[model samples]
Target chain A: METDLGYWIIPLAIIGGAIRVSTPFLFVSLGEALTERSGRINLGLEGTLVFGAMSGYALAHLTGSPWLGVLAAALSGTLFGLVHGVICSLPKVNDIAVGIAMMILGMGLAFYFGKPFVQPVAPDLPAISFGWWSEIPQVRAALEVNVLFLIGAALAVLLWWMLRATRVGLTLRVVGDSTDAARAMGLQPAVIRTCATAVGGAFAGVGGAYLSLYYPGSWNEGISSGQGLMAVALVIFARWNPLACLGAALLFGGAGALGPVLQSVGVSEGYYLFFAAPYVLTLGVLIATSSPTQAMTGAPGELSITK
Target chain B: MPFTSLSRRGFLTGTVAAASASAVPQLGFAGSHSPLTIGFIYVGPKDDFGYNQAHAEGAAAVKAMEGVTVIEEENVAETIDVQKSMESMINFDDAKLLFPTSFGYFDPHVLETAPKHPEVRFQHAAGLWSEGMPTNVGSYFGYIGMGQYLNGITAGHATTTKRIGFVAAKPIPQVLLNINSFLLGARQVDPEITCQVIFTGEWSLAVKEAEATNALADAGCDVITCHVDGPKVVMETAAGRDCFVCGYHANQSPLAPEKYLTGAEWNWAGVYTNMVQTVLDGGTIDNFVRGGLADGFIKMSPLGPAVSDAARAQFEATKAQIMAGEFSAIKGPLKDNTGNAIAAEGEGFAEDDIALESMDYLVEGVIGSTS
Candidate 1:
């Protein structure tokens, strides 16, 4: 309890918390950023996320391998994304409504099929000790990072790099910026969008795998607790940039940790208010960034929300 | 697959509705012995492996009885949707007894529907039956703190560090009471044991629960427990950290057999059977009931491998004393976290004491403030 760095542990804990809690946010928003970059919006990722969690946990329990569980989750997520993509590609179909329908379908399927997997313990994802740098056991435990977190961070950077540098990325950008131009250049907007959504859905599935196999490491009806939907808003706050998604997710995680952090330091007087820190910070971000007078500079021109 | 059966069931239900409306009065009469249908509503997935699962298991037990039909629904929120579901149970299924098993369902949904179906019986979980509430409604709850108190003994001895941790959903009296008992039990072995508690402000947030679990473990709590809707997050997170876990709601030892010390579980199967059997035997159930360990309302899971033999024996002795009616976990001679007297010395309160129901203070030895 004695320390020269007495109160600084709060910030350290928050940083550790941010890293621990933000993997799902990072993955889902990165996925969303990818999908939105090709002029399609998949609001159904929430359903995809929960379904992925269910699939991942169940498969992990059955296969006794956490890696296989992640694969199954991604596959199921891709299936959800494919269905959403195909349905929304139809003439006169509203992508938002289709997304909503997909959400319901995905959740219903997950809950109906996920019954037996609820009580079983899925194999845990391996952890790497980044915390060895600290001598304090508490600090070491706090900093003991999950392997999936590092993968998500690396994916974020790779995704940001690919969006600007790759051929496929250029095609996606052209499709997102202008449909008429994309068609003139021999690009199929629907095809590119569907592929983008499928990719997005796959990433979401991995995020959910992180939920059920790594962090909470259990499958239940209430497991997701709106983390998937929160990622949608987080994507918006990140301005559809994959690299920014990482920072935004960590920020959100830090905000989520604020209440618990304060209480840990013996400041419990306003802990209840700290529960709202994430939403409050999110609202603050949205207000500061979003204005009627200003266009979303990074937004895809055909993106549904900004349009 | 369901469309054809759905229409056929709709026709059957329509006819049953007509027959039931006319037979409602006669069905409740003294000589009536018509076969009965009962309904159970849940606030979460039926197989949530936690609170709702416990209720569903009890309902399943009721399903095995002869001359009774059990109809159950899951994931039904305590909103207007519950009113409609209750109406369907009465009209379509001809269900005479209904159990809307959620704390939030008591006020508006159950109360509003209770007046319209006076001939039916309503058994609500977490019901507060004041003078104004319906007389046909009965409230039932278990004192699970005794089990927590027992579980804490194993945790108390199992802890290499004097610091223990609890990840709770909210600071409700029921939850606060359990935390106090847990600490008191821990202090029984090691008086210097300090419990760190963090409330997530919501019932079932897995992310927050994981983060809280890690935070508690990092803060040096070797033995961690929880009083959330589900202890899945706490159990898995703690086990992941190589920390010993004490579970809640149902027996969660199965989740982490090696790491689990013991669990506080609700034995609703026996309780539900007893309640329904009374109704089947032409007895009324319109009373508030609270049962302790002896009554089989609250039970403890078997001690896990992590617990030492001495701790297990100590826990069993305390359990035996409770079952023999010689011990009460909520006894006085206690002080709140703010150093206020909760129970004066020699002024012990029983486990079922009403004062324990409204417990708003943290007991001494708890590290965090109640607020």
Candidate 2:
């Protein structure tokens, strides 16, 4: 009876949580959308994500500026991505195998380097107060959005536009649609795909930066919680669309927040089940939105793996 | 040092990486081939600053000991992964002693591996080893609940609002018992105190932990503690919210020294050193072992600057009583979260007593349910 008002607070908590949690997802999925749009599959972004997290957290702890940490994370992510891209560009290299190796390398490097950062606290990213109108404390806290969330939202729209309306976007779309066509058009498929992969890695790095600089921001070996892998699924579910990636990220964030939100309201009954609610719902959405015939509706024609 | 067997020759295939890593006092036995080989399996990373870290510290102590070589394989889950890790350590390394330090690995993995390698001593933490278990399979755990009790005393005095928050991994007996002990200790200082708990159904998920800490903070809980594998995320989030934090397993003071009040810590150095020494002495380990502050297995971290001197003094006094076996957190006249009585008349329990293992219900001051 005491927690009856939990129902009302749960939505607000989720709204706040979604924006907070979705920042990483938004960045990762957007990066992934760009990479996938270039006819390349970099499954190793998980590794890139974690490396970004470790480097970002460690650098933030050192520089005392969250933005520098973000910059360093993006750079490290770019390096890892470049390696994966070059290796995949080899005559006989399998993108999947190289992706897996890159993931392992990224995690191992992060683990080895992140050992020092396990105990230290880093500087926090600044937040914007959107809840000034609300007198309720919960609403105020929930509405205190991190600046990265705003940047991610704007980037998603910018990416969606750039991918359709820009020459570089046209070149990327052409490469992703057909290697033969890209080569025929003097686009140099490998070069464009490599650049796209590098750009994608930078985006993932920023996502990791958001995680360590803001909400639940700390660098630990287990910090990512498969968020990197989940972002890949999110991109697929979003049909590789940047705007849809934003929506999908928020959805996933809300789902991840479901258990804690319910617990806040005192529904201890089936509490264990509540924690599983997010994953179950995410899977359901992924399954429902992805269909047998409609699976590749907006998919690039030249993407080797998808074909 | 006694040689358990000559067949253990060339057992370990790799060099001890922790030899340079550990600075704690050790025996450092000479003759590489003659050294006693030991292995450890962790459910999570050794740097977790929590349960796994505590055990790793113990293992590190063992590594420093004379005639002992330590091999550690981390992130071994409770599933078949543990079995592979155990088998590899036993077969490839010929580890004479094995400490699989996760609760879930006990019945299925340790139980399956122990009887098969009777010559190899198997020591498990948070496991129930009895007649049903192999003699070589020993169980050892610390009375961390007592430390929690003491920390609760500190929390009670420190809290402006007696609303304490608990972020737990699961409602398993180990976690439930610790929560009860923490509440019991908090209520010892203030009878009106209440603890709201959230279980994330995971051993370690940092984001969920942060969200839970935020939720509890919004719900007006100013003091927070947790029983997850690692409490770093909880401590970070709690301190970020300007709430007082009670750490678990290891001291997270470095994470938030200003906000940290105190923590319930596990000092496995005693248990690990004793086990290794016992084997070297050609003696048998107690099949079931439980230790507390009296034995240096469970310890309370130094009180942070945030705690008042009076609170520290009171907690110290209570801790002394616990160490002296004069105070029992679980005794007669105890009741569950519901109206039903949990302890009947004349019920008695000690700090490290095995009788406290069946803790399934929340105490009166607890604000959450068991289900």
Candidate 3:
């Protein structure tokens, strides 16, 4: 069986892993993209993601429903987003500074409250078996896609469409592109940006739910290996587009899985080096896509990173 | 801004007071009637269910002793923060004996701090205390690989797939020893059994650990175990996937009661209590200390419900042999996975042999590379 299966296992495992690992990335980047589309950067999504994971897991363990856990995670994320937005909206408050503070606060809250939930087992989110016809157990396991991944994918498409062809999208763009124009249109830029950031936080919360409810499927202080923070980079690589964010997340997931997939195939030489695949991929993609000649292709006009 | 300035002045005054207070403990406190104060610092939370928890349990045992006061600082980093913690313990808490339990606390933190406080005995865990180091500094480690071997015996008997998985943090010698021993112990049960090992390249990465556990389960490894800082993620993930698990570092049966077979645990409670008692009796601990199952330094967790009667019988018998020094996990007639000779026929290294400490190769039937 080892000899016969050796040829295709690597690619098969990578594909399966890409689907499983990308859920959190997809959710966070989508949320980040939405926030950045309104000219705000929420770096605290890392803390938000972690806090959501803890709250979701704790709630799920107590309530006996993974779906409710997911809801609680999203709500907690929204609360975090609202807090970040409200604080950033205050006069003389720097969004980036507020974001950094929020990140620390979110993680601190999660770790403090998350101590008791570490040992208890919570109900896991169910997955749809797409490879039921396959007799190979690995194939079946790999094809078991979680429901959240599908929701994230659909959300990406819906978001992309909403950003392109809707009145609310146009208003957000106006508020993000030019504060004067937004006020000229009788719109409150703070109110619009705050709402957008809150929705983005909701997306990030669902992403956190993905971590503690599915995939790795547990809660701990180390559950996230900077994936929450990585979403910001991922959003930039995706050119602030929701659809592109989906593809970029899958790419990151595939790179992250490279080390373990190689080890499973008996390629243990330079094993530690393979673990650097995701970071290398990130650097390589950023360097290749970035230009020194002009503004980023789709950066929001008032975005702090671009300005 | 006003509050910040006030607090900064208060901190400076406190530091001066603490510096002066530190001298009291060093002045004839050893032979005096005062309680011996011992300080323990952990690199992570006290209840991490892994490496730090093992030490914390030991500290708890020492805390319960008569005429002994334990001062513990959890979540202390391995950087300058550890040095600061050591200083705080000595200067502010008046601790005469300090146990900086993290491995990274040894090199610069403990070494640099030990000299400044000659009266304080700084003992580190899992560090090699060579000559030329401060006389006040000592090191202690356990032959926990023996416990892993027993875990392997339980896992081997429980596994129906004839395959087992090991999730390791790194390819260090100490970790390698445990992996090899686990494989060898399983091979004793069934020669055809092959152990697949996956190195996550980190001590406490929950995401990678979970992914590795899932990959192992997907590859048909019915029994899974791991050597990481915290086995909570691996144990829970494996149990969720219906895979039997053997734990490492601490008892994890409570996490997966039904699926848990057995576990390799560090009996630091006994080691800590003994060291504390010796100090209280006006004695000094050895500069370098090491012990295995026979010396009560490491132990195996009680066999879980999943362990069959036959498996438990073999496990107990082999454990008895190990304790009596009649059995060696790294015995002769062994080869590396690369087919190179590790030990020829009728040759073996005892558990405490310095040769075993430098182990760099995985044994045959273990599917992994050290590099």
Predicted chain A of candidate 1: TM-score: 0.96
| Candidate 1 local lDDT, A1-307, one digit each (tens) | 2122447767877888888789989989999899889988888989999999999999999999999999999999999989888887898898888888888888889988998888777788898888787677667766778889999999999999899999988999999989999999999999989989999999999999998898777888887888888898788889889999999999988878777766655677767888898888888888887779878779999887777
Highest TM-score model number: 3
Q: Write the per-residue lDDT of candidate 2 for residues B1-371, one digit (tens) a residue.
A: 11432234223323242442254225433345576789899999898889999999988888889888899999988998898788788766668898999999998889987877889998899987878667889898888888888878888887777888899998888888888888878887888988889887889998999999888887778889999998988998888778999989999988888989999999999788988898899898999898888988888888999999889888888887887885688776888888778787778578767767867888877877777
Local distance difference test, per candidate? 0.85, 0.84, 0.88
Per-residue C-alpha lDDT of model 3 across residues A1-307, encoded as one tens digit per residue = 1122663777877888899899999999999898888889999999999999999999999999999999999999999999998988898888898898998999999999999987788989999999889888778777889999999999999999888999988888888888888899999989889998999898898899899988688887888878999987899899989999999999988877778878876888998889889888888988998889978898888887777
| Candidate 3 vs. true structure, TM-score | 0.93
Per-candidate DockQ vs. reference: 0.51, 0.58, 0.44
lDDT tens readout by residue for model 1, B1-371: 34574477568777765676578955544235657789999887777667888998999999998778899988788788887788788867779999998878988888887887799999998776767788888889998888889878988998877888898878888889888889888988998998988888877778888878877776777898998777877887788778999889898887788999989988889989998999899899856888888999988888888789899889988888889885777666888888888778788777877777777899888877777
* Model 2 chain A: lowest-lDDT 10 consecutive positions: A1-10
- Sorted into a CAPRI-style docking class, model 2 comes out as medium
lDDT of 2 at A83: 89
Distance from true location, Cα of B330 in model 1, Å: 2.7
| TM-score of chain A, every prediction, order shown | 0.96, 0.95, 0.97
Colliding residue pairs in candidate 2 = A177-A302, B27-B66, B28-B66, B29-B66
